[model samples]
Target: MTERQQHKRRRGAGVAAGVLCVCLAGSGCAQSGAAAEDAREGEAVQAVRSAADALVGARSSKARTSMEMATGGTRVTIRGEGVYDFRRQIGQLKVQLPQDPAGTPDQRPIMELLAPGALFMKNRGAGVPADKWVRVETRSLSDGNLVTGGATDPFAAAEVLRGARTATYVGEDEIAGTPVRHYRGTADLGIAAQDASDGNKESLAAAAKGFATDKVPFDVYLDEAGRIRKVRHRFSFVNGQMNNAVAVASTTLLYDFGAPVDVRLPDGDDIYAGKIAEE
Candidate 1:
């Protein structure tokens, strides 16, 4: 070939080689990026699954709870404040029911004691004397006490994260002025029941069977110590009275780690055993 022709061929070959190199590099980088994303997702799932254990490591915390039920264009919210001892799996809450449709307070706040397998309530209305406490087995409740209690047990709420089937880190946020990492995911109640602690396993299993769907969607925030600062779970169940499904959102906020919490169960004599009236 002539010199100029050979030079032109050489230039074409160089250009083709450079293009091939760039293409190969781009493919490698794309694969690496995907692998990194997978690793991040795995880490997030592991972090959420272990958040409940982190609460136990903290021992105790003061908690605030809210449960909102919406049906037929009406929304009612129940609020509670309490302290929980994660290690002992016990706590106490003062739960306030919403006002009646007339917007007048009809009853006093109920004092609740949460234990391993039982729930105790004072000021529980419906023809029961305020002085007598009513004891209910958590396992016997169809909603597993998650909704029936008006407020979810803080420790139990955290335990729900143990069943996180999929989780995505949703960036950072603050709860009550403390910095936290947010995560969103869905948890299988059946899976959560299987992984839950002995105290909560049966109750969660009951909830798994009672709820409209086994999957519960949740949003959770964790502190630097990996302890859950705030968690919200969405649950749906058929409301017998309404004869329809009710959507309930339960939120638990935990703070003041290592807080002093003392919970004493009611004595047998203090618990009312007569036929209880239903509201």
Candidate 2:
């Protein structure tokens, strides 16, 4: 940690900045400032909805995500992917993996379990029942994707803003240096008493009472035709810890498929160790 960073405790300007950083890069089906893009909003929502529904039915996904997590001033980088075995009826949403697979280093696991319940986590082991995993997947009011953890899940968050007294569209901004439009709102999503990546799973269950199903602030950006371009959430008492995901400094649309994002299945022989996704 940098000298300036080490001094920051759980609550500080540093914390606010980190939370703002996350909101900006967050997700939604919104497309802003363009006639052509606005015309496509309806199509975009349908596409996302269909894809999400298909995923629940078929059980698999293939894609790459570059993730950066910053707490106070500490930031970590990781590559993420989602893989599932239909035959086994199981899915693994990997939030982090090494860019260099050759080293085959013994690394920690980032698996979110969304089947049968809600949870969030990283660095967990294998063979635990899927329901026990730490991850939550639900229909996003923004752009539906089996969102893993954090404020990614849509409905879980939207409900928090239900009948929110104060709401408004701010200007535009950036996250992690990426550009985006901004929206702002307020509500009361409770607190968390534990670390999402660590700590007891039961505590998480109680903590989620606020996180997974409570009230909080939200900022949603729509592209041209009110298509959710990006979404941000701010909640407190989460895990009884500091809260973020509230203010949207930026709204970025990560993926857009005129159609479905089909997941390519792996061949039996090709599914060996060290064999990640291949084009």
User: What's the lDDT for all of these models?
Assistant: 0.92, 0.38
Give the per-residue lDDT digits (tens) of candidate 1, residues 16-41.
99999999999999999999988988
Task: Tell me the lDDT of model 2 at 233.
Answer: 53
- TM-score, cand. 2 vs. native: 0.37
CA RMSD, predictions in order:
2.2, 21.1
Q: Pick the lDDT winner.
A: 1
lDDT (Cα, 0-100) at 185 in candidate 2: 54
Residue range 1-279, candidate 2, lDDT tens digits: 676665775458778988887776452323233555545544443332222233233333333344344545545445554543222233344565443335667466565433223334434444433233323323221112212242233222222333243454466666434454555655433321121112222333343453444444556544433333345554333222554442211111322312233333333342222322222
